[model samples]
Target: MAVLKPLGDAEMDERQRRMMDAMLVRGRDYNVFRTMLHHPAAMEAFLGWGSYILSDQNTLSVALRELAILRTGALRRCEYEFLRHAVIARQHGFTDEVLHAIAVGDRTPLTDEMAMVMKAVDELVVEGRIAPDTFERIRSTFGDHTAIDIVWTVGQYSQVCMFLLTAGVEPDPDVADDPLRPLFA
Candidate 1:
């Protein structure tokens, strides 16, 4: 059960309902977003930044960004976060084998860039900063724009994953059929 339960439509204030309805219209009424609506002000403020990080505006490729997100969730042992992004990663064309490999640090199936970025995610999530050498490697390979986005993606998603894990936010029942569920650690 969730320590801070997600609100149903009826439980929301006018402001929260507006926010949630916007997502519902977009087919993104996920449980974490619902749980976040408990603080409409905070969630509203978070939306723009969240949008940027997930939007076309982000310099990193969707596939690679999802990889870092999966890695962050994995390092935190956050099932909700990892599993949700696993589905998103698949939609972006990553295979189940690749998703599992990213989540569990099995880099053999990943590209050099994918493996390197996942290692950077580990540094940010577990040690609170990316190492200088790794940052240089990222910058050299992907350029400054992407290198910075990787850090922000890992840093932001790590915080969000911590919230989901600590709040004990249950996955939406619909998530049960996701292929990643079987491989969740």
Candidate 2:
């Protein structure tokens, strides 16, 4: 059960309602969003930054970004984050084989670039920073801007994983049958 009860439409004030409606327009009514509505101002602030991180404006490609997110969630054992990003990973064209590899921290058959990103995520989660060689490899391959985005992407999702776990957020019923559940279970 969620430590913070999610706010339903009928319970929202005008500002909250508007924010919820805006999210609905984007075809998402995620429990995270609904639950965060308990503090509308903070949710609004998060949405702005979150949008940028998930947007085309971010230096990382969607696939690379989602891969980092998935790995972070799995490492943290945040079931909600793992399952949610599993879906996003699929949408970004990650195959089941790749997803499973990420779930278990197996880099088999992945290109050097993919493996490096996963390594970076692990380093960040475990050491709070990527090693110098990994940092340089990422910078050279993806450029400094993308390297920074990679750090931000992993860091942002790491924070989200912590929030979801600490808050005891439940998985959205709509995704109750998420295939990734068994892998992380």
Show where candidate 2 strays beyond 4 Å. none
- The sequence of per-residue lDDT tens digits that candidate 1 reaches over residues 1-185 is 68988889899989989999899999987999999998888888888788899988889998889998888888888889888887788788899889878877898999898889888888888788889999999999999999999988987887798789878898787776777766654
The alpha-carbon deviation from the true structure for residue 24 of candidate 2, after best TM-score superposition, in angstroms, is 0.4
TM-score of 2: 0.95
Best by lDDT: 2
Per-residue lDDT of candidate 2, residues 64-182 (tens digit): 88889989999999888888888888887888889889989999967888899999999999999999999999999999999999888888888888888877888988678977788
What is the Cα-based TM-score of model 1? 0.95
